[model samples]
Target: MVASTHRDRPIGVFDSGVGGLTVLHELLVQLPQEDFVYLADTARFPYGERSQAELQEFSLQIAEELIRRQVKLLVVACNSATAAALPLLQERMMRTTLGVDVIGVVRPGAVHAVAATRTGRVGLLATTATVESGAYAEAIAAADPHVDLVQVPCPDLTEIIEGGFPFDQRVVDTVRRYCAPLREARVDTVVLGCTHYPLVRPMLQRMLGPGVTIISSGAPLARQVEHVLGSRSLQAGRTEGEGTYSFLCTGDPEPFRTMGTRFLQMPLGEVAQVDVAGGALAGGGPALA
Candidate 1:
């Protein structure tokens, strides 16, 4: 693990692919003065299809790389990874010199969806692995026992969004296909359980109608991040000046840089390519090799 914390160190965020940029978008807006380091594990993209053990290994490798960069905090922006690896990741971080805090998306989005529903019916759209993991269902039940959940397993939604042409008719049809059950279930509030879904939120809203409240991990998670920083005194405290951010990915950086701007809605200054050496990341993985 790296040395103890530095207040000026960037907050680290990671996902299986570009999906996590939705979370980064919110972080950039909510914590404008705080620097961030974002990692996209695109070499093994679409974590929905990966096994739980594999996801944990990939997460630990990514975390080790981020910790080497000396981030003050870590956010698991991928639902599939979060469902499988958050506990292990947190435990590993606790043994580190810095003991960085780890935040995942399921609980925050689930709680918000539960609160947003007026008809006691909520919908969830996530990757197959995330849906199968039952993380959102458990979180929603814990938050509000009275709420009913309708979950849809989107096996290919992430891949379609990752292709970079999201506003096309095919994308709309795919979203509509996933949203049909929510309409049938009469869910008044929906949890966009996968970070990539937010990019197609307008289409989702149109299909599900104006009344359905769409809850995603970004804004609510941003609030939680703010609270964590203030409580722990880890905030950058950079008043008046905006903080900078950069990108790291295990796959080719060219496509990452081109496609990332759409999801991030901000200039992706420079993207560096990294290779993750797997197996036991308790300081085993090298930094951005």
Candidate 2:
């Protein structure tokens, strides 16, 4: 075993549930030498329907949990959480002694969509909270002021995908319904604004047709992670073999392990349980119910 250093500390990532694993899959492939610690706040899963206040509280709780584990950087892989809490999370991290860098999914996906679109018309399919947050709109506008973004709030899509994805008729119907407006808009690029959406990428592509480019946060977010690690000189030093990863969840570890292995599409070796009950997180601000 090599001696541990500040650079060897694992990157921290959190999501409401297993959806974030899609982002993790990209990171594992892009930065094979870096270790990661991913936390699933399954106790507060399906952030899509939650209010901004609730999502922010949940995000802060999860951030404190990951920080306790000595993470060198932080990644918020859930769109709803990012929409509600990215700025707050970044501020909290900045106050930490380590000042861990924080990155989120929405902006990266928006930037990629702007770059990929030929018609300057981008489509977004995400949860209700994410759509309402206006994060994607701001990000796309910042990337290119001339770009037009068509947003569809898929209130039930995240839950459908999170339920697991052999993708039944209901899932197909839901996806088709969501894709209709984008197809009508004739967007040249469609952004999978929610991490869970990537798992059903094939269906999305089939529905959107071959002429449209599909963008997901995984690839672009992975690139951003690489850039952050390089700029901070925090890249892991393990050169000969791939690095290790571990899991934490506020809900049952068994289900997270089972669904996570499928979502992650990789060996989910072990999953530990974490409790962020009110009394446990003083720094997270009076705990959330």
Candidate 3:
């Protein structure tokens, strides 16, 4: 069994922005007894356009900051970052004093989609960087080589959702445009490859129709988290009381609090600001302390 003190440490989750709140929501629901510290790199939001090297650097920086908080595990909730940096992050985490496990948003969803598909055809909707990275395709192919994978790279969908929720016609049009190819492919399963896409899931469902199974990273990733924690004997011992959750953001905390509440569909308690200097957290936030 892992040390009791290590098991008592919070699970750290990070994303480029509020999008990762969707993933955190599942963690909150499924692992209510475990504390969570979520960090949003809002100062560098919209990770969809960054280069692979930039993403790796950003992810490593975030991992180090989360490690500083004594997190028992690290979750890279952004698909773009996961695609670009999962291996490197995992390697770094293994070298930590705690040997924290690093989980990301791609493989679990891919496995889930492969299981959900009836026609051996799967579709993926993701940001440009994630799609271009070919992460989902690799994951799906690894899970089931026979499964045909169709990918749609939405260059602007993340921005559209982030710009405003309760989307308008433009959002509808963008979703439709993205789903058209998937619809044409007649895929019975679709993987939502971006963490932010869940915010527009209803619109995506309508666009893709009821016959398709939509797999997002949240639910499956939550299960993986449970398994990992349990296997390592790191599950929280609390049997009744709910766990506490806190927030940290590299940008202004107010916007993160406001936007995150909407995304998580839960009251986001205090949000603390993270001072990022040279891409590393400089530790100004009370949450970071």
Candidate 4:
């Protein structure tokens, strides 16, 4: 861990691939005054399939790199990482890091889902590890045990989205197939457990129907950021200035740059690449850091 300046530095956000861009988009809308540094671990993406130990190691390495960059706060925008590494990262930070704060998406999303469900029936769609971890179920149960929760693991959804595949007929068909149980349960609200799922909201909406509310962690996660910043008096004071966003990736930047723009609905310039060697992040050739 590095010494933190605790200055008004940019907030750090990261994901397994480009999925976290959905969270970043909401953060931008909610806190436009704050700057952000986003890192996409594209090298070992589809974190859905990685082992718990591997995910934790990768997450800690990424967190160390972000801390080195002097980010004021860290957001684990990847749900799989959140499920596997959040507790360990939180403990490590408390003991060794400075004034920076770290938060994960599961609790925030779960909180929102519990509040939003009209019939107390919530459906969760996420990666296999996330479902197996039972993070959502625990969060919802802690908030409201009365809430009926259904967990559906959509194994390959992240890969499809990250690969820049359209949420066309095939994708919709896949989602419908995976969500059949949730639909059969007659749940009125569904939680998009994976960060990548937000990118295909339209398809989800169409399949689930207008009556069934679909929620993603992005908005609630952004609200959590705002609440934390306000509580700590770390809120950016500039209300009229344009916010800046910095992008970094662990793999080739070209594909990320191309897919990122469409997902984030913003033009992305060259992205900087970082290499993870021996479970540590090393700065590679700089395109844009």
Backbone clash numbers for all candidates listed:
0, 0, 0, 0
| TM-score (C-alpha, index-matched) for candidate 1 | 0.94
Candidate 4 per-residue lDDT, tens place, 131-176, comes to 9988899999999999999999999888877766645666778887
lDDT of each model, Cα atoms only?
Answer: 0.89, 0.89, 0.89, 0.84
Cα displacement (angstroms), candidate 4, residue 96, comes to 3.2
The residue pairs in collision within model 4 are none
RMSD of each: 2.9, 3.2, 3.3, 4.4
Residue-level lDDT of model 1, residues 196-279, one tens digit each, is 989888889999999999999999999999999888888885678999898999999989888999889889988999987653
Worst 10 residues of 3 by lDDT: 280-289
Please give, for residues 204-233, the per-residue lDDT of candidate 2 as tens digits.
Answer: 999999999999999899999999988888
Tell how far residue 264 is off in model 4, in angstroms: 0.9
**Which residue pairs does candidate 3 place in steric collision?**
none
Using Cα atoms with residue i matched to residue i, what is each candidate's TM-score against the true structure?
0.94, 0.95, 0.95, 0.92
lDDT, residue 225, model 2: 96
